[model samples]
Target: MTSAAGATALVLALNKPVYPLYVWFLAESAFHLSLLTALTMPLYLAVWHLSRSGKGRAARLGMVIVGIVDTLAIALILGGESETLAFLFACLMLAGLSFYRSEVWLSRGLVAAIFVLFVALEGRIGAPLMPVEEDDMRSLAFLNVTGAAALAAFIMLRFPRAERPD
Candidate 1:
């Protein structure tokens, strides 16, 4: 997920001409996007280290928090038109898949938080921090849609499947 986010941002930054609206006034919009995505790597690494240390619950909680906050921040930075909200759905999927059935409360709480955040911010948000051309928002939207889909698919594939009862 982290890698995908960074890669998408990089692609956007490198192909400025392809997204004129995105880079019209703020030629650095894509660059800033890449930077923000890169900044989340260390937090993801810390979560990985915690999981490796056998702190399963803490790691799961950390993942949920980091994923939610990161997605929300990106959505806010890009504004509603970029369709970055797609990543919030990815975050919800992560929370749902991160916990065992026994940890229902944690999963429910995290999912609810994501749901509330999505509802509150979806269309209610204002323009992006760095405004882009109206037509160019489609480019960002495409990147976000594919990025979110890839993240969701990767998460589903990587998570362990439940054992069947005899």
Candidate 2:
């Protein structure tokens, strides 16, 4: 849950005012990617809390739903503009699985698959799904990507250290 909160704060704080605007604008404009991404936050929080409360199976189900939505969002939003977001979503999904499921190998296998996909996609040419943005915004978006990945990694790797109810 801390990872979720930290990732949320990092995303919103770093982008400051514009991130919300971007989200709102994309939502209002009916851009599926942005809308879905924004929607995933609350669902993720729910899953996190549920897992913390020992409703692991429920949490895992919610995580799967979120992952599916994220996958659709990425496909609908395709291109370089969606790259960072795609990776972030993958990280979040894998982290959730690792944290909530007893089957660790499944999560690890998915991680390996992600790595393979990235390696396979290397050097592929692509265009932005949305219009090219100002440099500052681009850099900030990249920060969100890296920040999300870091938080997900922390959450998964430190799973054993998380507080557990007696």
Candidate 3:
């Protein structure tokens, strides 16, 4: 998830004809991705260990917290971007991934929506969803990066390795 976010940032940054704030964009992307991993990995590992040791309650609690954080972050970022369809897709996907035993359906739905959105946006199927503001672009980038980090943390915490007794 962090990789996806960073890649998206990088792609957006490079899509511009002129390279302004190129270095900042790349640096922030990397920093956010790494920060996300750093914050989430240990908790995921700990949850896995706890579950393997038969501490299901604590693991579940941790997962709930993860879910809350992920939902909030994604909501903030997508809302900030004014990507309503994407936000809906993200919310559904996150909910399914967090709560459902089978997440394949949710994944498929999100993928399809994302593909359609990408194509539509590229082809200008409708008016721009959000106004493009040059000054706000940098701030938007920062919000997205932070939101992506939060999302990555949630994903890692929610879908940890299955616990198996040795």
Name the best candidate (by lDDT).
Answer: 1
Residue 131 of model 1, lDDT score: 59
> Taking the tens digit of each residue's C-alpha lDDT, what string does model 2 give over 1-166?
3344334333433333343455444323323334434544555566566666776555654554455454445434534444444444555455444443466665666556555555555335254456444553355356446645764664455444546899
The candidate that achieves the highest TM-score relative to the unseen native structure = 1
TM-score winner, 1 or 3: 1
User: Which model, 1 or 3, shows the larger lDDT?
Assistant: 1
Candidate 3 segments exceeding 4 Å error: 1-96, 99-107, 122-133
Each candidate's TM vs. the true structure?
A: 0.78, 0.50, 0.32
Per-residue lDDT tens digits for candidate 1, residues 73-163, read 7677778787878888877987787788888998899899899988988888778786576566776777778767877786676666678
Candidate 3 Cα lDDT to native: 0.39
Query: lDDT values of the candidates?
Result: 0.66, 0.48, 0.39
Cα lDDT for residue 164, candidate 2: 89
Q: Report the CA-based lDDT of candidate 1 relative to the real structure.
A: 0.66
Total residue pair clashes for candidate 2: 0
| Tens-digit per-residue lDDT, 1-166, candidate 3 | 3232223223222322222243235433323222222233344455445545565445444443443343333233323332223323333344344333454565555546545544554323332233334444445446545544554554546454556899
Please rank every candidate by TM-score, starting with the best.
1, 2, 3
